[model samples]
Target: MIKPIVKDQQLLAKKAVPATKTDRPIAADLIDTLNAHQTECVGMAANMIGSNKKIIIARLGPLNVVMFNPQITAKSNPYQTEEGCLSLIGKRPTKRYQKITVKFFNQAWQPQTLFLTDFAAEIVQHELDHCNGIII
Candidate 1:
C-alpha cells in the first residue's frame, strides 16, 4: 500500500524500533510510497510513513532497496550539504558522509552488509538519521 507522507515533526522525531519479519508489510508500504514520490524524493524512512520501525527505502539507480534495521557501522569523508525531505518544509544544512558501511537485513530477512559512497551513501545516512530520530 502507498501510505500518506507523515509530516508531523513529533511523529517523525521519534526513534524507530528494530523491524522484524512481521513488519514485512511495512517495508512493502515504504517501497510503494517511495515509488509514488520518486519525482521529488530519493529515499524515505518508515517514520515518514507513520510506522516507527527501522525500515527505509532508497532509490539506487533503477532499483529501490529496502533496508531493515540499517546501521551505519562506519563512515568517512564528511562534508556539509543541504537536503530536502518529503516530510519537511524545506532543505536543511546537515553533515553527511561520502562513504559509509552499513549492516542490515534485506527483504528476505537475511543479514547483509554494503559499502556505499557518494549520493547513495548520503541518502542512506539521511534515512538512518530518521531512524535515529534526527530531524535533519
Candidate 2:
C-alpha cells in the first residue's frame, strides 16, 4: 500500500525504532511507496510513511535496495549537495560522505553489508537521516 507521507515536522522529528521481524510489512510498504513515486523520489524511509521503524527503500542505479536498521559503519570525504525530502519543503544544502560502508538487514531479515560511493552513497545517507529523525 502507498501510505500517506508524514509531513508534520513534529512527527518526522521523532526517532525511528529498530525494525524487527514483524516490521517486514513496513519495509514492503516503503518499497511500494517508492515505486509509486519513483519518478519523483529515489528513496523513502519508514518514518516518511508514518511508521517509526528503521526501514528504507532506495534505487541506486540498476539496484533497488530495501534495508532495515541501516547504519553507516564507515564514512569519509565529506561533500555538500542540495537535497529535498518528501517530508520537507524546498531543497537545502546538506553535507554527505562521498563514500560509506553500511550494515543492515535485507527484506528477508538476513544481515548484509554494502560499500557505497557517489550518488548511491548519497541516497543511502539521505534515507538514513530520516531513520535518525533528521530532515536534512
Q: What is every candidate's alpha-carbon RMSD to the true fold? A: 0.6, 0.8
Error of 1 at 107 (Å): 0.6
Please provide, for model 1 over 1-136, each residue's C-alpha lDDT reduced to its tens digit, 9 standing for 90 to 100.
9999999999988999989999998888998888888899999999999999999999888989999999999999999999999899999999999999999999999999999999999999999999999998
User: Mind giving the per-residue lDDT tens digits that candidate 2 earns over 32-110?
Assistant: 8888888889998988998988899889887779998999999999988999987888999999999999999998999
In candidate 2, list every pair of residues with a backbone clash.
Answer: none
Q: What value does the lDDT take at residue 136 in candidate 1? A: 83
Per-prediction TM-score to the true structure, in the order listed: 0.98, 0.97
Root-mean-square deviation of Cα positions for candidate 1 versus the true structure, in angstroms? 0.6
Off by over 4 Å in 1: none
Worst 10 residues of 2 by lDDT: 27-36
